[model samples]
Target: MWVCLVVSVALIVARLALRKVRGQKITHGDYWCLCAAVSIVGRLLANHFLLIYGSTRILSAERRIELLKPGFEVQASEIITGSKLVLATRSLLICVLWSLKMAVLDLLARLIMKMPYERKLLYVFWTALFLTYLASIIPVFVGCHPFKKNWQIHPYPGDCVIGNVWLFTYEVSNILTDILLMAVPFSLILSVRIPGMQRLRLLFLFSIGIFLIAVSIMRIVQGHNSRVQSAHTLWASLEILFAVIVAVTPTLYALVRNRHENTTYDKSHLSMGATARTHPGSLAEGDRYAARVWTELNDSASRTDTTSIEGILVERRYETSDVKL
Candidate 1:
């Protein structure tokens, strides 16, 4: 969990740096990423408390009875504290995961803003996401009766510790939203005419969300099969770690591609000049052809920018050729 937290923080920092280097304004998506970071920190702290107090859910029936016996007041208090931390950890985990969903949605909305149909589809997605988010959260608060029992150490209902209904609802909603979010970008990518490599990169970037779904399912299975709260927390942390990585990957790829293109442009400019000087006879014809190709590529790139990934992925490049003399 600590390793996941550290890597998540580093990725968030790198995301900000990448935007600065690219001269791109920080968008709503970036704000969402920051929000996720804060939630992740809170979750980590809650996990720490759980560690110190030790989750009540992990205690066996005999162990719990032993702790509740007279003269075990200190142990009882610790169990109560860990039980509360369990709730806190679950809440923070939800916050971090949903914040990431919003981040990706925000970016995808911007990328496809000009398409009226896609925009409508995005609205549908947004509505579904909100509804599912509520579904996932409501159980956290209402799943247990006499809410205080949520932290009650003994003589509390099983639902107070781990609500099966909450687990089922949250997992289903989580996976549903992930699939919906991934579909939007994927459909857009398929409808457009991007280079094969660029298309592949975009597909791969969005495809990483599949792992989030897998992690969510695993969390549910672990929760049902194991009595250990720490195991559940571990799976939750892994989900968040993968979410952060997926959120930052597109921007990182854009930054690297931009640098490589700039270098290639400079080298190509120098080579073009050398070609004109060495083959003076074909200079004018070659110049005209090169100029036309450059204009076309630039025009196509500009048009693609409106719908491309952060306006950084679908650039059309000119392939320089030797002048015929």
Candidate 2:
């Protein structure tokens, strides 16, 4: 869990560095990612204390009674503390996952900003995600009656301690939001006219969400098949870590490709300069003409807004009617 937290922090830092290198302004998505990093740290600390307090151990009703006997006051106290930590962990886990979801939505909103219809669809996705998040968290607080039963030891309701209802609610809501979030990118990809290779790369990057859904299913299955609480934490941590990685990958790809293209252009420019210096008659004229055409193309591209993955991949067409060779 600590390792996952550290790696997530590192990825966010790398994302910031890439933005600085590319001379791009920070967007809402970067702020959301920062929020997720803080939540990940909190979840790790909660998990640590939860283990120390011995709250993660599954206990039967008879075992609860045995532990609550007169001789085990310290053990009972530890169990109560652990139960509260369990609650904290659940809240932080939700914060971490949903922050990443918001970050992705922010990027998607920028991608389709020009299309009013697509922008409306993005708003619907935002509303769906928010509603599902509420559905997932409401049960955590209200699933157990009397509120104090959430941390009570002996004779407490099963829903308070076992949380089967909350778990099932969270799993369904989580999977539903993930599917809705992925649909935006897939729809944009289908509607755009990108090169085949670029389209394939975009598809693969967005398809990482499928792994997140699979992980959610595995968490549910593990929770049912095993009596251990640690297994759930393990899967939750993996899901959060993978979400952060997926959110930053597209921007990182753009940064690397931009640098490569710059390097190639610089090398070619130098080669043309050397050739013009050696043969100054016709080659010099050709070099000057090439520079003018390059300037015009750059000016045209600058006029178009290419801030998102789809924008970056879509081919730009330039008219050459005004350029005299």
> What TM-score does candidate 2 get on C-alpha atoms?
0.77
Q: What's the count of clashing pairs in each model shown?
A: 0, 0
Across residues 1-325, which tens digit of lDDT does each residue of candidate 2 receive? 7787788878888887876786666768888988988888888988887877766236677778888788988888888888888888888888888898888887676554433254568769878888888988888788678877777776745655677777778888888888887886787666555457656777887888888888888878776645476777788788887888777776566555564323432333343321222221222333332220011001112222222111242321123233332
Quantify all predictions' global Cα lDDT against the true fold: 0.68, 0.67
Q: Pick by TM-score: which candidate is best?
A: 1
Worst 10 residues of 1 by lDDT: 290-299
lDDT of 1 by residue, 107-129 (tens): 67655433324457787978988
> Model 1 Cα displacement at 108 (Å)?
0.8
* TM-score, per-candidate, Cα-based: 0.78, 0.77
